[model samples]
Target: MNVDLDTAKEGLAVLQQYGGQAAAAAGSLLAGLASPFQLFEGGWGLNLLFFGVLGLLAYSLVVLAPRQ
Candidate 1:
């Protein structure tokens, strides 16, 4: 069996579309993970403190630490 140029082009286009969608989804997930305040909204009290601590921990663990 043999494939033509048009079929290969169409396949590539489809792959590109899927790749774009996956990238977009990954970006959204990262954005959501970047903010913990939104997920645990509290009215300027212990809830805010809790979220702040969580955010700090996440930053220190992920950003401050060196990865191999």
Candidate 2:
């Protein structure tokens, strides 16, 4: 099937934006995991706990956000 040029470009733009976001998230997670001591200069346990809390916040925001 032949796709319109503008439609194809829009699709590519969306894909690139999503990829960049994913990469940034992965990098942050890796940074937190790779250097627990360096992450806020605390131990791995604390670092993990921080990530857990962060995840919970995001989860709650998604699940509890008012639907449009």
Candidate 3:
């Protein structure tokens, strides 16, 4: 059995569509992971304290550390 050029082109187009969908799904997953605040929103006080500590740590790293 032999395949022609049109069949090969259609196969390539299908592969490209799947690749694009996979990329979109990956982006959505990363967006969900990257937000610390939105993940713990139900407990307001705890969320505030958690983010405050994160901010403090970031500030300490950026501001108080000696430049190398």
The number of clashing residue pairs in each candidate reads 0, 0, 0
Least accurate stretch of 10 residues (summed lDDT) in model 3?
A: 34-43
TM-score of every candidate relative to the true structure: 0.51, 0.53, 0.51
lDDT of each: 0.83, 0.83, 0.84
Candidate 2: global Cα-lDDT? 0.83
Poorest stretch of ten by lDDT in candidate 1? 35-44
Residue 26, model 1: lDDT of 99
For model 1, the stretches where C-alpha displacement exceeds 4 angstroms are 37-68
Residue lDDT tens for model 3, 1-68? 79999999999999999999999999999867765546475566776788899999999899888674
Judged by lDDT against the true structure, how good is candidate 1?
A: 0.83
lDDT of 1 by residue, 1-68 (tens): 79999999999999999999999999999878866645455454766787789899999899888663
What stretches of model 2 exceed 4 Å from their correct place? 37-68
lDDT of candidate 2 over 1-68, digit per residue (tens): 99999999999999999999999999999977776345666466777788889899998788767553
Per-residue lDDT of 35 in model 2: 66
| TM-score of decoy 1 | 0.51
